[model samples]
Target: MKPADVIALPFQWGSELRHRKLFHPRGVLMSGRLERTAPEGEGLPLVSGPILGRVSKALGAPGRLPDIGGLAWRMETPEGSGKWDVLLASVMHGPLSRAVLRPILGWTGSEFSTLMPLAHDDELWWLRARITSTIDGGGLALTDIARRASGEGLDVTVEQALKLNEFQPLARLHFDGVVSGEDISFDPVVNEPEHVRLTPQWLTDFRRAAYRRSREGRDAPNRPTPEEAAEAKDS
Candidate 1:
């Protein structure tokens, strides 16, 4: 199955707080512009479920938006295998609102080049920038780097750095105000409105590329056989 196909499922995002185990005490949905209190266990670290709108209903959040959401799920696995952990992610970009993702996926626009701020904390960025400068200069013994996997305000699954195929998404998405995949991490009052834009074709292309590369890299061997290596050396 293609990553695009896999990602086509109704998307949901939220946080998986690990007070003990990998559990999602808070989860939200961007599919239908809804919010929920999150479901515990029986499914989490949330892999899949109805979108956040329906989840809001389940969690007792009134439906301001009239659209009924479909399955809501996130790629959360804080514990990898355990209990009582929170998954932090969001459905910023996923299956189209309806059957409206095809053309967007095929279009070629400059939307992807639009650099949006991925991190929110300016202070943190400033401090990290200083540390990065130190490292770039000649300093060692890492200063800004967290001592442990989990650190202060480091909601592991949500705000941590992203891997090649993994993304630590925010549970809440701000579409109108912020164009990035983060919530109102900046000055909320002045950020205008929080809104998320549709994932243009450019994004789909990027995703497809990422998926292809990931799959290929995963399936491909890191080292070649002795003969192959010898042949490479000879060549």
Candidate 2:
């Protein structure tokens, strides 16, 4: 895996918070756009989803946007029918203690916000990101990454000295199957590290919420989530 070279874009926090704005269609649809991308591209295809228009209509805020941050990757390989992709979106990219991180996969915020495709598998994984701290002088930071493995399971890992981004993704992803993007899932409630496996009820509730969002294709109710949509592309 090559080091990610990403620069932060200007981020807005208040907009998404207004009028429960993030829950509005626009917020969901914008997220959906980031979710849909062409696999043939170099890293993140950055494909926009078909429901963007609906989200836009639902979102009356002409200029307001959501507080989004994280990374996206399109794995290069010869194993699956289509290219495998990974997306990590941070709903709350703030500093919090382990107490806060344990529940929502270490995220200090809410919602189901990550989408990643596996080259050798057929399910989509939702992931979360937490910035550990800033490094001395490399425009980098030590970060802890988390994702669910199942409805009651999750996996956690770390990416040392990753580029910091306040708005856009913190880094670019280019892998040659070294970091397998296959059959990955995350569930904070039941998947926390053994020591912290017993998650709180709130975390479990949030997980269920995210699951519903993914299963419903919140932004495009007419379409299936990426996991179910995979067949349309491969078939």
Candidate 3:
């Protein structure tokens, strides 16, 4: 397995985050939403942009991957609620795309989905750290300091600490948000609790992309090409 793959295995296996509805009859709501609000910015943080771009290029050529520009959302769920700067650009996962809009589009029979954690403070931080690490090796280290300074006092497990240290950039989504349980609601798709807006055109494009991807999957085989087969045989 590739080095990145080997590193990612632990994260994948150790994670328990799963996608769920905005409201679950069996699930108890956490309280309020965690949030982060930043001054308007055009592109991603300068530190992580180039790094993420480099890694994502391996997944697909430009414009083919999922991109999020200036994503500012307020999530009020059972888990922590906060508004943060989400510079999610070129994510290659379908489920993740679905989760962003799961509350509204979920009942529409959309095939996309994502796994979410009941409490995801650490998970989200790590995900963001992994992305930032690409720009600088000190990504997690910097966060460690911030986490402590914030006084949330959440413990970082040994495994999580280790993952933070060993993480490499596989994706790029810069994040900075404060999480707490406050007046949070998930009904509004755009223009809600604060300075966040998701254009209808953008959502439409995303859905179209998902559809194209699905159609491609149904029409093609994922097998390696003849050249790859030859290389494998020789080895």
Candidate 4:
């Protein structure tokens, strides 16, 4: 195995012991629609379709604490040929700062970014989402956001940029309700569009290893906690 795969073993053990995802364990499942708003361009072809999404706080932090926000979703690709999964995290809108994820106290008015560039048609592009609607007063709870979405609809604008800070509208995402009883896990590394590729092969390898280990941990048979396993190993 590669060094990255070996190094990801602990995360697998951790998830198995915790019986949950190592990151973003808690989230709200949402049902939404993505409508293409921009004309065909040199960028990715943003498709219009029904979407299933999850909004979560990284580290599974409580609603009151600042946390890295996550917006992950799955949608159909052109001609219903396949599906594309996208995972974005809260990030700044500047040139250099856009690469860094920032924790936010609430979800509203936050900007989410791909953090890494995607190669489409031999050109690099970045995807982003901006929360355009307001949720009253520290709207951090899952149910609160769900309620608002079901009633007034939570609106977000999806954008794309060839370079940082020069985003153009790509689509409008509207969350109409909370999806219940459906467990969904998004792995963009494996579920991306066929025409597009994530840049930096090393990063993709690392992410693939991590995701594989996480899935193994989640699916493994019940085992002793990491501490207990370590003690047994030491003995």
Judging by TM-score against the true structure, name the best candidate.
Answer: 4
What TM-score do all the candidates reach, one by one? Answer: 0.23, 0.23, 0.22, 0.91
Which is the leading candidate under lDDT?
4
TM-score of 3: 0.22
> lDDT tens string, model 2, 112-151?
2343221212222123333332212221111211111111
For model 2 the local lDDT of residue 204 reads: 45
All candidates' lDDT scores? 0.22, 0.27, 0.25, 0.83
Model 1's TM-score against the true structure? 0.23
Alpha-carbon runs more than 4 Å astray in model 2: 1-67, 71-198, 216-235
Across 61-179, the per-residue lDDT of candidate 3 in tens digits comes to: 12322212111222332222432322222222332342352211110111211111111222231222122112222221223323332343221100011122432222222233334
Residue 10 lDDT in candidate 4: 87
Better of 1 and 2 by lDDT: 2
Predicted structure 3: lDDT: 0.25
Q: How accurate locally is residue 59 in candidate 1, as Cα lDDT from 0 to 100?
A: 21
Q: How many backbone clashes does candidate 3 have?
A: 20
lDDT string for model 1 (106-206, tens) is 11110111112222222110000001011121211111111211122111111212212222332331111111242111111121111212134455445
Ranking by TM-score: 4, 2, 1, 3
Q: Whose lDDT is higher: candidate 1's or candidate 4's?
A: 4
Q: If candidate 2 were superposed on the true structure by all CA atoms, what would the RMSD be?
A: 19.2
Put the candidates in lDDT order, highest first.
4, 2, 3, 1
